[model samples]
Target: MAGAIAGTAILKNLSPSKGLKTITLTINNDCNLKCPHCYLQYGKESFLVGELTINSIFNSDFEHLAIVGKEPFVNKSSIALLEKMVEKCYLKNKSVSVITNGIGLTNLNPSVANYLDYIDVSFDGGKGTYHLYRKGSFDKIIDSIYNIQSKSNVTFNALHTLSTGTINNIDDMMSVRRFADFKIIMFSPYLNTLHDGKNDVSIVQLEEILKRLSQSTDFVETKESLLLMDIYHTEQEGVSTETLKELMSFYQLDSKIKLIEKDPLNYGIIRVTYDDYVLTPYESIHPKNYTKSPYLASGVNLNQVFETMQNAFS
Candidate 1:
């Protein structure tokens, strides 16, 4: 979640509150594909967040929840958990979204889609370029998108990672917009590589592409996509708690970190790990090898954990 920060201005406005509005639950560490760029720190055994902790989170003040995974739809077990999460969200009057790789999407219960606000399918690239990073599944993912859209009224959006390899086939990737029913095609810079800009799209190149995407009529532009221009302009050697702190210090960002400075009850985005640790999205994604995060037990008061996050980020 905390990878690159371009300038002081960008740091001053890390993200608007809307971007941080959801609490993402990483339900499992199981998946069907082995993408070279996968960010997850895979565990030896399959992991699933317990229902009690999930219910507690739904009962909390967060207005939205996101169900994500190594691939949430990888198996029937994960798909069942997704249905439960969606039911909880509906009962609590909160919106919900699922970010999936579209590996097993068509097999899901059609009724589940009616409760969802969004179904964000991951599209690393398209056709020739996608197979380079994700390997042999571009056609599968594309079919999943088409099938899901035809079966349900759920809003569809595409999440594409712009990397040194994929950027070269920008036209092939953008072609998905012409056929898929994506309301917004979001983009995130590939940040799993070393801090050097070598494996990433340079700021200058990304800027030009962002400009075109912003002005294009292919799909609706989103604030989240526009903010990426700032994220790519800066790069770090690695992702860690210290490296993130240094980036903030170098950018002279103190209370200016408006991203998580608000009351803990309403921090930008909170992440609940597979084992039930409450953490910021940055800590959950980076893990212990890169960052250190407190182990807030599953049943701990949600407010207390939120307070800890406020102190850490604000």
Candidate 2:
């Protein structure tokens, strides 16, 4: 929650000609750590997906691109994808980002570093738990964060996934302080996942925790965290009017925070795998679900795909 970037825009109201606001590419599905909650467990989906060509991503119209995957930095092919996105997507007036574990950022290619707008790094614990869950050197990740921030112009973001175990340890926040100019966004575990984590903290509980974390560090952008936390809640609960109003009233948040999650699939956010499988609305659809539907294609047309999903969900 320690972000200085502007509040997120409601991507659902995109202009068709301008293309989607953001598309998340799992540039590489191979991860360094095999965490329990990872979504790469669908063997059937991988079996059906085809190769993603450079032209396919470069030609796609989107305002922002999030370069993600098993470990985007570690993947050789992802490095190629990043260079292409920087050359193509950045030149076309699109913003590009990468959500990483903060391990390999210090050694990023100059071309890749030059075009990046944001870098979201993950860390669940401050010093102790950070070592346990992620299985990386805490000192090393922090060094990477510091090195990246010092060497690049990109904004920094800290992403934490909360559960019954790590939520209570607030001291780990000090680890985030190393990224002096960073923002923070904590995530809640979801149901029906490749890894169904234990009981998730409720909307009320998350609100309280976010409020507390906001006060914990100046690095945390409390209001933005509040907005995202609320968005997460709305998405999980189907955005009911009663749940929304009550939660908004509790935090005194404006109604516009409701904008982000309303129609995420059509929100112009597509997640393409290394093999070119389009996973729109990363939150709602699982990687394997594409196998269950005809959505798995050699190449996808977003407008047509959006229309199909909208009609089905509507």
What is candidate 2's TM-score against the reference?
Answer: 0.74
TM-score per model over all chains? 0.73, 0.74
Q: Ten-residue segment with the worst summed lDDT in candidate 2?
A: 1-10
lDDT of 1 by residue, 16-69 (tens): 453334566777878787654556644454877787677667656766777766
* RMSD in Å for all candidates: 7.7, 5.1
lDDT of 2 by residue, 50-138 (tens): 24444565565666766665566665555665666676766788777777777776667654676877777766566767777667777
Measured by TM-score, the strongest candidate is 2
